[model samples]
Target: MFTLPHHIEFLSDRWVEEGRKFLVGEAPKIRERPAPAERLRGRPLSVSGRFTQAPPHMNLPRDVGCFSVHFDGEAFAVTTSFDPAADLVIEGDYQAALTGAQMVGIAAPGAFRTLRREIDHLYGPEALKVRGAIADPMALEVLSGLFDHLGRKTVENPDLAHRAARQGLSGKIREMEAQGYTIVENAITPEFADEARETILRTLSMHGHQTMNWMLYHGRALERLALNPSLMTLIDASLGRGAVIASLSCIRRGAGPGFIPIHTDYSHVPEPYPAFAMTGVGVWAFEDWTEASGPTVLVPGSHRARRHPRSSDDPGAGVPIVMPKGSVVFFTEGVWHWQGDRTEAGERVTLHSHFNRGILRSLEARRIDEQMIYRNPPRLGEMLGEDDWFEKTTAAGRDYMRFNYMRQLLAFNEAGKQAILAEPQAAAPTKSARRAVPA
Candidate 1:
């Protein structure tokens, strides 16, 4: 049976009724620039005269939050505005800078659509000004480098593939004990990680081959998305402004190796602002994914936290996202969930490649390579734009959101994703710090 968490129940009005209806038979289109597939990535043509420029070291205005780093998008060099009251900041890495420029190139149209949609919903109006693509592309260029690292380092490493697998498992255990969940960022070196790509794919493929809905996996999709400059820039745009994870992982089957309970990432992390400004998980695989194989089924907006704990009620207390190989699952992790898609056939296996801001603690047991992020498909250029919207993607700032969420949640490993999901929030402050909880 399918169940949904409450936080984003409002979306039911659209996501379930309209959105699901749209996706039931027809899948989202794959185009150079297709509209949102209830998500991001890709565009068609560049807008004319939309790109703009800004002086070095200057901030545009708070109203232009839509433009990520366009603090000063210029021709010679793009500038990233860190502080709302400051000028744009300058950086180097032209090859990568070109990538950011590419993102800016698309921002005029890309950001417009995204902001329009977002504003329409939350803001209840188009408060975001859809300005032409101005603002230097430099800042975002540097930002796009995040995905670049993911591709380069992992793919380049000779021993990385195998190591990542074994290490991932090991790291998961370690992080679970220390932090309740591990939040790994760059647990492995770039060159070293490259070797693990194939092995990772093999694991998912072998385990997924027996399933349904997700039998189509190629293993190279996420690698491409990692490299796409526009996409990378969008991911990077959040580098300084907000939280960006180079890599992320969460562990369950915790509390001595049973099943995980139901829960959400955002709920454990929650919203309202960054006590740990959690983020969505963008997973990539070395292969294709299918529903039968083991895709993570998400109860969208569970990040809003309306689901009650069902661990006391059922082992599969919540829904397990059925993520297709190479597909990214962007949802608040602190919500409700329990692993599903248990086909009684093979051992469950998967790898998580994620990103997050630096300040908060993560559930990953290992680090992620950012260099490789740009090399793979799901090209980066189409992922992020360069104009004011592009400028807005430059994320940079300290974030503590989602810190120790995994660690704390996993403490109840004996429970399940649902059991953990059902656990009440700490109405009263705990006596020990999260780190003190001891796995």
Candidate 2:
């Protein structure tokens, strides 16, 4: 079946090798078809790509990433060097190029136009630079089709499976399904939590406010944490694919009484909420959460009630979610929850990442920041609502490119979730067993 490897780092040597394999493997079947064979007529075609500002994590050997694929009518060759005389040359920001590659397949027939529109809208026109020209117009279409097929076979979130397995998230997912909430302890390293806490406090100090929204834009730390792979997997499982960010907010609470009352997150809805969840929230704790430290309290199995908690409804004393620092608690499906009283002297800092299903409107307005999109991967754009079809309209029509792209992405995510769920649950290690392992 020539299945792809479970993981392939983008722009790595392995990625280039797999790309060559895909092209070489698919070319024969493509040539067997009469239309492409007649159009090619044993003539040669080539494509050269140059990507700049490669993210440091890629650790690319070259300052500027370059690759060329040459088809000598009957066979294909892939190389790390560029070909100036190639029929087409694609040069752009590496991240934008990745976003294009992930989406090209869904924008077929108008792939070129769609790609240009998306790049212009998200990364500015200069983000993607095209050069050279195809002698035969049909050759351009053929090349587009070939790239589309190649893209579908490549360009995916490589960390989902590894992160899920490493974190033992299947058990957490099962717990969430039954209890309407689950906590991932030590999800982020204590070092990261300390850094994030400092950033939030500094931001709060500068702004002279106790709370803030759009925290993702304030610093690199918040931005990175918002797209945390394990947290994102939980969000996808609870809210389905194509979930957009409703808000990323921060709060610093001092010793005081709990101000927020018990309620469900479902904002304007009739009685008996839908079986599916429309929104979800992941709250990150920068410090150890204890009963006296004022952690969130959740009514176990209250989501099954499928309605808002009435004032007269005594849900009894709820369970306080107590976990160590660098942990996050995610609750969805209209879970009834509220803040706990803070009796301790120190302040508690938290960041809340709230997301809504793709079909629903977000609480925060969509803000497309090119620098933000360029700095991160496509995952950032997806959360910012850049990859979805909603609210994208002009006199011409709705943006079907984004619409189809999201559809394809959602299907892929669902498949990934199913695979995660199907895996056997591993038993938790005892304290002594954990201590025996090297740090």
List per-prediction Cα lDDT, in the order shown: 0.29, 0.73
The segments of candidate 1 whose C-alpha lies over 4 angstroms from its true place after superposition are 1-97, 100-259, 266-276, 285-288, 306-325, 344-349, 362-439
Whole-model lDDT, model 1: 0.29
Give lDDT tens digits, candidate 1, residues 86-180.
23322322122222332222233354343234223322232222333424353333323322222221111111112122122223222222222
Per-residue alpha-carbon lDDT of model 2 for 1-439, expressed as tens digits? 1112322445667666756765555444365555453566577888898887664445666646788878788767788787777888988877567656654344345545644664554456788888987777776656666555445444334334433543457667766776788777777777678989999999999999999998888887787688665688788888876789999999899999988789989999777999878899999999999889998888878889999998898857587878788889999999999999999999999999999998888888778888676545566776777667788898899987777766765765666666766766546633522321111
**lDDT of model 1, residue 15:** 18
Clashing residue pairs in all predictions, respectively, total 164, 0
Candidate 2 off by > 4 Å: 1-163, 419-439
Q: Model 2 Cα RMSD, Å?
A: 13.6
State TM-scores per candidate.
Answer: 0.31, 0.64
For every candidate, C-alpha RMSD to the true structure in Å: 20.4, 13.6
Residue 176, model 2, lDDT: 71
